[model samples]
Target chain A: MSASVSPDWIAVDWGTTNLRAFAMQGGTVVDQAQSDQGMGGLTTDGFEPALRALISPWIAAGNLPVIACGMVGSRQGWVEAAYRAVPCTPLDTVLTRAPASGGLAVHVVSGLSQAAPPDVMRGEETQIAGFLQLNPGWDGVICLPGTHTKWAHLSAGEVVSFQTVMTGELFALLGQSSVLRHSLDPDGWHDAAFAEAVGDTMAHPERLAARLFGLRAGQLLQSTDGAIARARLSGLLIGSELAATKAYWLGQNLAILGTGAQARAYRDALALQGAHAIPADTDRATLAGLTAARRLLREAT
Target chain B: MSASVSPDWIAVDWGTTNLRAFAMQGGTVVDQAQSDQGMGGLTTDGFEPALRALISPWIAAGNLPVIACGMVGSRQGWVEAAYRAVPCTPLDTVLTRAPASGGLAVHVVSGLSQAAPPDVMRGEETQIAGFLQLNPGWDGVICLPGTHTKWAHLSAGEVVSFQTVMTGELFALLGQSSVLRHSLDPDGWHDAAFAEAVGDTMAHPERLAARLFGLRAGQLLQSTDGAIARARLSGLLIGSELAATKAYWLGQNLAILGTGAQARAYRDALALQGAHAIPADTDRATLAGLTAARRLLREAT
Candidate 1:
């Protein structure tokens, strides 16, 4: 597929820990590749080299147009794509030009930022744009579950408001680094424990800090299994998040943009609360968002 | 202070990170010394050597009595000093004996445990015993601030119930290991920011996970100072704790058993809520608790 396809353009999702590039022939993907040289571990000058290393085979000819999104445009990334203030559409037509070599024309998509509540998003904005493009005229809460989970309220094709929660990050830190690490089995899961803990924290969200230490104590006193402890930990963190974001998900048309076990956990949690959330694949949303950005760039030019 | 004193009985406070010993001449501290041989890094056979290294000078003759408290008595320490159930005094008159060398008879103080809520404490029980001994017949809530901050309610001479929060551990992980580390100043302190954040989370404790990501976002969008961010993180964590344990602190005679900046922070946070928490020295409490344990051992023998 790589040798047979002479890509017209490239769709790049360059986030903190990964760099995925898709060779595009018009509206379809011809070939794809990914690398670990994401914005996180690279220096200012390393972006161009990283991109060339991944997509150089597809860029056989000169003057290849490239559309990039996520942290690649962050302040610490290859180039700083300025943040567009929200209460507007997720995508901006005016793409930020990044200095490139090997005859590559790199245009980075801008991130979205909220002023009052002091929230910001880089990679998730593209995913939101893609979700909106895939399901046009959609106006509801779109939840993007990841390391930094985002919940955005959409109205009239615009992001009216949104909030970011560090649930995934908290789970990782607590399960891996905190005293709870000793009690949690990394690969274990218990459905009943998860549901019970979710219900417990949802009802008494203020008791989060108090409840956390119980996981460790449970192991010590009752010999609670690592699987039960793991599930309970996940439930406690997610439950607190759900309780906080009740204004966004309660009685609203919701779609969660993720495809992994984490996404399933969110769905299961919401289901326990009697809310059914439509699942959307994150990769599809990202590609759709980048495609929408590609069209916007073409229209502006 | 070290060479002049030949101690009658030694009081040892061995926790997860530090080992401190006090040379006691019948209820009074003659000389005190400390080492970095905490229980966290020691093997089963290492506890005796660690303890002897620091107090070998004081133990000129064989058969010196030692009363030790904290993690040194846990299942992972020199020996397991079984946890005493609640509705009982913090320290047990019947102490666990660790295998000692050099003609030493080492007695370990028993920790307190709660069955319903599933809580456990090691060293803090000793501090509570000391507080009870010093303040005689004290009935109220005792707050011990550290890695695992404990809040215990006392009625008559028994611990009615207690709760533990990993507020200090959370602060360390979020500030030093999480993404928030980039925006936090290790030594920075902002009194107003701390107070404001404490109030914010106290009123809305469920929003902890949602509010945490804002620290990183605050740094990105607003250039929030490291000091202010650090203080806010502390406020957020502590405020959530206060919210969860409102049952223990509200309208109760409260005393905070700590002397460090962390103890003062708890005091100031409570002060903001118009609740005054009397400050107590932790070292004094430890010594007093150990002395009490010594008396218990004498009576038992």
Candidate 2:
């Protein structure tokens, strides 16, 4: 298969379960595509073919400079990129050119890792870079909530340290799989119940490990409505995360980076804690980061 | 139905999903029986016949005093016994006699509840009562790890405010239904991997929500052996539980009350945490609780 030379560059945000690609001409995405061919998917089917298939239409149109982030840089991704250890700045971001295939220049981004409890982030580094590009002079905390909610502490354009909370994924698992699932009303948010639970959890956050059982008991005893129980459980989790990250957000400029539905919930939660949650464009940031990396590569050349 | 003359008391531990009865002669259980007449099942079948059938054998011999616990005390149960609020002693335990049923004394135990962020326990109170009887002067925590793991802090004869964790039910649900379950080895526990995961989780306990995706990622990337991944995920949850409850067991004596295969796992986990875990007799404890409640009633009369 031959690669065409139409699009100037390709920006990819590849994560554990999904692959997203944007075709950029003069640093703006002209066309977008996505596939189930995430880093997770490629682990079984192999990397090259999956990447080729996802961007085949763009690739067929033109030979483009490709910048990819996320698990594609993990030991299990298409190719392993060495982790950039933290206190990472824009300059510290590791960039490696991919093997030229069908006349395309592919650059895979390096994942970031911290030594102290040995935490790591793959695609999020790109998001952080994108965040930095938009809010150039801003410095404080950027919280990206998801399965692994990242709380990054930025100082002088550098990511000094960050903490990740497993809030979203835990809620999904508990709500869908556990007995608590029976008690959850997933359709709407019960603010009163949620607030009550969040307040209780904030007061005695340690009790979260214990209070989960109350969902089943409350349902059986009719003391708690299904919707309220679900809300309470969700509140307990979000509250615990809030307690852990309170020191990071207290009296600091806080920005929350999220997409669509999750972002809305996070915004509501941040308000409860009296923190400013400015929604950063997740897609825009990924493209901006890729463009920034591409320009850096071009400038060096 | 006519009541038999001066029948010995029959004890019942009718819970949400199952009903168990004991024919007590003096202080010993001379005959034992069980029925699928769980509160869940009785909700459709009506409570009267279900209760009669469960103890018909013992009833045929003599009209026995039936003492019940668990969901049998709920509005959905045979009768509602009302909730006994927290910081409550055994004397504070609500014991309600069954409504007019021909000289038959059916006393149902009350469920326990906390204040705001209300948590409640029904079957557990009986278990706690049984534990108190067995260890008269003991002062420590009795952990009943199950669908809803209960951690009771006992001082003298009173049950101090205890907490409940939904560990077991969560494990079962995530293992059987969640997306991660697809990547599990399905062959059961892999000890080395499980232990490693437990250790890793203890170190970075907060990553629990995100680390879950790794199961699916590993399966896709082929970086993780499916079997090992499953065990590792299980270990991660167990480890998280251990971390969450560390303070609960740190300086206090720990005794795990469980039975059969699940009990063995709890034993291993307790050992890992350097806590003393004794397999309390589950059947014996239930029987003992019913017997103790009966004696208290007869003595009060």
Candidate 3:
């Protein structure tokens, strides 16, 4: 197939399990495409082919700068993009640009990491950079809820400090794979149970282990609906996260960057605590981040 | 395939994934056989076939009593063996006898369930009943650690109360399926790291979410050994469980009824907390429980 559009730049967010590319003519998005050919699905050599396949139609006559984010930059991904330690500007952070091996100029944006306690994030940093680019100089907390939900503190236009919670992953595993799966209704949800569980867990998190089993017991004994079980399970995990991250969310300017139901869940969770979180589009944030990174590359040349 | 050996009575412990039958001429186990035809792998009508396949020779001259326990009694199992409510004697608990089918006397032991802050245990109850039989009049707490680890309090031969934690399942899902899989050596383990994680989590149970992510961060930034990561993962999970169940373990005469490396890990974790836990064989517990229940059936008849 011939090139669909003559691309000036390419915006790619290659995560562990997903590869998304937005072809740009000038500085605007002209065409976009994605594939399941993520870093986790490819070896060291598979990254280039996977990328080319997704954006093959976007290939221009000249070398097109491809600004990529997410796990595609990890040591286990295409090219090893070392993380820039925190207390650094998310946008100004060092970018690991892989040399043009073919017709593509690949720049893998560096992720961010924390010292002392030790924490790291790969693709989320780019999203943060994009969020910062759009919001500019807006300081406080930005809660990015996803598989490894990130809470970043931004000030002086930099990620001051951040934390991550495995809430989404835990929910997926417990809901679908664990014994809790028996009692959970994957398609059903009860908001009241969710709010109650959030409040209860946040109050007494020491009972986490006990309460998790309660979901099953309640289903067997009290004839509790699976919807309640699913909601409570989600609430308990997210609630516990909120309890631990009280330092980050309490009395702060909060905005949640997520897409679809997950973002809504986080927004609802925050509302339960009397904190109204402004919702932002995650895909838009990624596109914006990639666009900004490509601009940085242009200026550098 | 012919009968390996003739049998008198059969001792069966049919779990979710495995079926083991001890052909007993008397109280002594004369021959032992097992199959992968656990309840989870069979349907209601398939149970009889599965049993006969495991112990075809043990059919005997007459209808030999086959006492079974565990998730084999679950609603989804062969026959719906209802759960006996708690605050009852573990050994003297009710046994649901399935009707004579295919010339086999099959009796499925009832699992225990707790009310108020509900909780349930299917297989562990049998293990507890067995533990109680051998350690007659022995009071205090017995911790049976597995996929869903159970902690039961015994007083005056009655299982006063119990709680379950999904620690093993959580560890398995996180290590094998979650993002932490990257930083983990699935086959590796370290004692010191495990102990340290146990102590840390136990001391600060509130930091559970934060500490969980630390496992991944430590691996990436600190070049942490996978063994340490594995041990720490186990420690963090088990430690948090202990912290929640502190009411049951602290200053309590505790015995860990488990087997293999996981049991040993529990022993080590307890030892770190200035508590020396006595280890008991899980198989022996199941066998003894079934034998005791079978004898009770005979006396009642």
Residues B81-130, candidate 1: write the lDDT tens digits: 99999989888779998998656889998898999899999999999999
Q: Rank the candidates by DockQ, best first.
A: 1, 3, 2
Runs of candidate 2 exceeding 4 Å displacement: A1-6, A44-46, A90-105, A192-200, A214-231, A268-274, B1-117, B132-147, B151-162, B167-281, B293-301
TM-scores of chain B alone in all candidate structures, in the order given: 0.97, 0.89, 0.95
Would candidate 1 be rated incorrect, acceptable, medium or high by CAPRI criteria?
Answer: high
Candidate 1, lDDT over the whole model: 0.92
Best by DockQ: 1
Backbone steric clashes in candidate 1, count: 1
Q: Write the per-residue lDDT of candidate 1 for residues A1-301, one digit (tens) a residue.
A: 6577677889999999999999888768888999999899999989998999888887756657899999999999999999988898999889999998655799999999998788989988889989998899998999988888899999888999999998898899999999999999998999999999999999999999999999999999999999999999999999999999999999999999999889999999999999999999898899999999999999999
For A170-202, candidate 3 gives per-residue lDDT tens digits of 998899988889899997889999999999878
DockQ of all candidate complexes: 0.86, 0.25, 0.73
Per-residue lDDT tens digits for candidate 3, residues B101-198, read 76677888888888976988887877887888888888899999888889999898788899989898889999998878888997988989999999
Order the candidate numbers by TM-score, best to worst.
1, 3, 2
| Number of the predicted model whose lDDT against the real structure is largest | 1
* CA-RMSD of model 3: 2.6
Query: Which stretches in model 1 have alpha-carbon errors above 4 Å?
Result: B1-4
Candidates' lDDT values, in order? Answer: 0.92, 0.73, 0.84
